[model samples]
Target: MDLTTLTYIVVGFTFALYIGIAIWARAGTTGEYYVAGKGVNPVANGMATAADWMSAASFISMAGLIAFMGYDASVYLLGWTGGYVLLAMLLAPYLRKFGKFTVPEFIGDRFYSKTARVIAVVCLIVASLTYVIGQMKGIGVAFSRFLETDYTTGLFIGMAIVFFYAVLGGMKGITYTQIAQYVVLIFAYTVPAIFISLQLTGNPLPQLGLGSTLEAGGGGYLLQTLDRILVDLGFTQYTTMEEGNGFNMMMLTMSLMIGTAGLPHVIVRFFTVPRVRDARKSAGWALVFIAILYTTAPAVGAMSYFNLINTVKPGEVGAEASNLLYEERPDWFKNWEQTGLLAWEDKNGDGRIQYYNDGNEQFAQTATEQYGWQGNELTVDRDIMVMANPEIANLPNWVIALVVAGGLAAALSTAAGLLMAISSAVSHDLIKGIFNPGISEKGELLSARLAMAGAVLFAGYLGLNPPGFAAQVVALAFGLAASSLFPVLMLGIFNKRMNSAGAMTGMLVGLTSTLVYIFTYKGWLFIPGTNMLPNTAEYWFLGIQPESFGALGALLNVTAAYLVSKVTAPPPEHIQHLVEDVRVPRSAKEAPAH
Candidate 1:
């Protein structure tokens, strides 16, 4: 079958499977909706968590970003997976032992203060909404590119699918669907990686092949060749250090790490398992799955760079670089062209496309004169790299179809989880806990479904008018998480005296400072041209960009919490006992009867 037919088949069948799972595991009570009744096996929950966390960014954009940005992209790799280590070792087990259905529930009961709980709720909402915006946008971009639909229409379709499973089954349906999604997405992600690795390095594994010799240049270090070609084309070496200010890169990496730890959608996944030990084990398992992608990405980037440069060099295909015609474009080039992702212009009268890093000072003049080029005209978005790679490598049509399913799975699974978080907060924390203390389980479940529907509408609207690229807005989400939610949870667990006053004050301070910093540089909510920073060195704080400031925000949060706590009376003995109870999971009782 052809690519289009195969895509419809694969995506259609996967949708059918998900819908089937939703029907099978439909939520019947509030417990099922909120926590999947806390009955999921550790391994299954771990796989589900992996699917919920990966998203379109992992399956579609991460390799592409690594391919183009080279070393600068390491921050994403380290920051995202490293957060799992913190969650596994520090946060997940304790939260699971506390045995609450949602994150806010734990915070509220732990502090014995409804106000503290509300502040925590606000922090979760901000982090989750920002995070979900990126996922919805990713879904829209994927559908528009592959399904041949407009972005807004694609978003509505995606939202409809999410609503079908999420509103009906809640976390129970979401968990099984996510496990299925994990299987599909991983296969989708790795199949292309394997194909590309074999083509470029004669190795089947992308991770090992990245460090292997370059098949394109006969026999040379792949990274070394990429570095040389990039330098020749006015770009930086793909394997070496970046020339951007050292402090800024350091700050940026740190910020991404804290933000990873702080994200609400990811943290809430840990609460679904049965035991504290299982929660910790599940976090480790999630990391194991994530690492498979992280380890292979750098290799994919190196090989792709070499492949891209080989396509541009003169005399390779018996065609003049200056007179190459559009009809003769490679299949990968033609494929992406249909999606409007790859474009070219003969700026220098040279028909060949040149896409160097645009950072090599030594070759800058040569680039301008030899090519007669004003600037690079190729406009391939970073999100296209992994999604389009199978087509790029001339893989089978079925593999290409798998790619489409994989992208959808990545986006939809995460969306389901995020919606679950939003709904649980509304129904359990806000309604049952506060508004209607006598509410029945059935009534709470009804509220959860309504909240899910409303949240999806709000998120779809954001996707229709995406503030920026998915990854860029996601960074802001991480910063918010790092600064606000992470510190409060950490102090609440490990420290005995972190009272309601301290946790409350710290969350506000951290939230405000991080938001102010981001708004100052990214504009109030990332609207362009309204920012206070020059968006350049002249206005940066010690050369650090606002995007890389989340780590500092986390520091501010911990500092504020500590300072405020010391000035106030210590938390009551009962709260300290709660902390102790969380640590010793073996001594626990069953979750309080609903």
Candidate 2:
């Protein structure tokens, strides 16, 4: 079959499978809706958590970022994976033991104040909404390319699919659906990597292939070859970080780590398991599943970049004939060009696509005077790299089609989890916990569904006008979570004397500070041209990028909470005792009933 038909068939089958799972796993009670009735097997929940945690940011965009950013992008890998370790060891089991349906509920009960819960809900909503927008962007990108639809139309189709399953199944449906999604996405992701690795390096394992010698035109270690090619084209070497970027990298990595631990959607997955021990077990299993992809990402990124550079410049660098003629461009280039994610202009009327770093003035001058090149002639969106990698490598149509399904699966699974978190915050934490304490279970479930519908619409709108590419947008969401939620959650569990006044004050301070800093650079609410200053490194506060400012905001949160708690009254006696109990280990016989 042709690519288009195969893509339709594959994507259609996955969507059908997802909707079927949703129907079969429809939640029947509040427990099921919020935490999958707290009966999820640890292994199944681990798979579900892996699917939920690895959003389009992981499946679609992280490799894209690595393709363009080179070594500087390693922070994302380190930060996100390290952050999971923090979540597993420091937060997941303890929170699961607390026996709450939501993070806000734990804060409220732990702090003995409804006000604290409301603030926590606000933080969760903001972070989750920001994170979901990236997923929506990924969905749009995948659908627009593979389904041959406009970006807006593709986005609408994705939104409808998510609304149906997420609204119908809740956490119960989403969990099982995610397990299926995990299988599809991981298979889709690794198969292509394996193919490209064998083709490029004669190795079946992408991880090892990255270090192996190239078997094609170039006969050097893969990364060394990539570095030479990039440097010859006026870009920095691919294997080394640019000078002066170390501090920012460290800060960004720290923010991502803490933010990962603080993300409400991932934390809520732990609650789906039956016991605290099961939560820990699932976390370990989730890490294993997560590692399978994380380890493969570097290989994919390097190989994709290598393939892209070879395709665009087929001959010696800077030679007139080296540039690929615009007329002779490959089919993948034409397909992506139609999506507007890739474009070309004949600078200097050369009629050849010169994809190089025109920003390097020395290189630009040489190209202008010697090579008769006017400027960079191609624009490639980083987000397109992974989705286009298979086509760029001339992989089979089925492999390409599988990638489309994988991208959609990654985007939709996380979108469902995030929407669940948002709706639960509104329905369970706000309406039931505070506004209408006497609300019936039936009413609460209805409200949760309505809240989810509203969140999907809002998220769809934001996706239409995303602040950045998928991974960058996700990094910002991580920053929000790190600054606003991680500190408070940690304090609530570990600091027995932490009071409502301190937790509330810290959340507001951290959230507000991070927002102001981000808005100052990223624009107010991410509206283009609304930023107070240019978002450049030189203008950053102490050289901290907005995405890396979360650690500082978190620091401010901790300092403010510590000072405030010292002056204010300690938490009530029972609340203090509750904290102690939460920390104490329980044997199987002593475990609390679900």
The most accurate candidate by TM-score is: 2
Model 2: per-residue Cα lDDT at residue 112: 88
Compute the lDDT for candidate 2. Answer: 0.94
lDDT values, one for every candidate: 0.79, 0.94
Give candidate 2 regions above 4 Å deviation: 586-590
TM-score of each model, in listed order: 0.94, 0.99
**Model 2: lDDT of residue 107:** 91
Candidate 2 structure quality by residue, lDDT tens digits, 341-423: 99998978978889889999999999888888889988988889889999999999999999999999999999999999999
* Local accuracy of candidate 1 as per-residue lDDT tens digits, 349-464: 65556554344554555666655555665777777776667766678888888888988999999888888888888888888887898998889999999999998988887666
Per candidate, the number of residue pairs that clash is 1, 0
After superposition on all C-alphas, the RMSD of every candidate to the true structure, in Å, is 2.6, 1.0
Candidate 1 residues lying further than 4 Å off, grouped into runs, are: 313-327, 349-352, 357-362, 584-594
Number of colliding residue pairs in model 1: 1
